[model samples]
Every structure is written in C-alpha cells, then in structure tokens.
Target: MRKLTDFISESFIWSVGITRPKPGQERLAALYITATLAASILAAMTMFLLVLHRL
Candidate 1:
C-alpha cells in the first residue's frame, strides 16, 4: 500500500511538469522557428531575384 501511494504521488508530479510548457521554452521555440522561417524566405527571394536578373 505504501509503495502504491508513492508511485501514484510520483506519477502525478511527473505528469504535471510534463504536460505544461515552461514560458522560456515556449519563447525560445517560437524565436527559433521564426528565425528559421525568415532565413528560408530571404534565401528564396534572393534566389528568385538572381534567376530573374540572369534571364
């Protein structure tokens, strides 16, 4: 019975932490994704302009 109770308590704490995203983690992820997308778009536009100039 004691072991079962301990197991349940540990599981609850683990689930709570795992289920929520920390604010800093969310912000970091957003910044990383935004930067990657912006870089990709800039590269694509540069390539397009270069191709147009060649033709």
Candidate 2:
C-alpha cells in the first residue's frame, strides 16, 4: 500500500512542472489576471446587452 501511494504521489509531482518565478514576474502575472478579468467582464456585458436588446 505504501509503495503504491508513493508511486502515485511521485507521478503527480513529476506531472506538474513547478518552476521558480523570475524577477518582475509578479507584475506580469498581475497584468495577465487583470486583462483576463477585464475580458470576461466585457463579454458578460455584451451578452447582457444582447439579451436586453432581444427583449
């Protein structure tokens, strides 16, 4: 049982490549998140407008 569990755990860890972040990468990540959120908001707003127009 322990061997099986260790194998599973090791496979999971190797499957994920967790690399250290480079300098100033936090700002880049923040910008990406902001842009993604903005895009989602724009899409939602456009859909809402379309639904209202059809009514």
lDDT for each candidate structure:
0.58, 0.58
Clashing residue pairs, candidate 1?
none
Clashing pairs in 2: none
TM-scores for every predicted model: 0.57, 0.56
After superposition, which runs of candidate 2 have C-alpha atoms over 4 Å from their true positions?
1-23
- Model 1 steric clash total: 0
Task: Estimate the Cα RMSD of every predicted model relative to the unseen true structure.
Answer: 15.8, 12.1
Q: Which ten residues in a row have the lowest lDDT in candidate 1?
A: 4-13
Which RMSD does model 1 reach against the true structure?
A: 15.8
- 1-55 per-residue lDDT for model 2 (tens digits): 4454444434433565444236667445445544565688999999999999999
Worst 10 residues of 2 by lDDT: 4-13
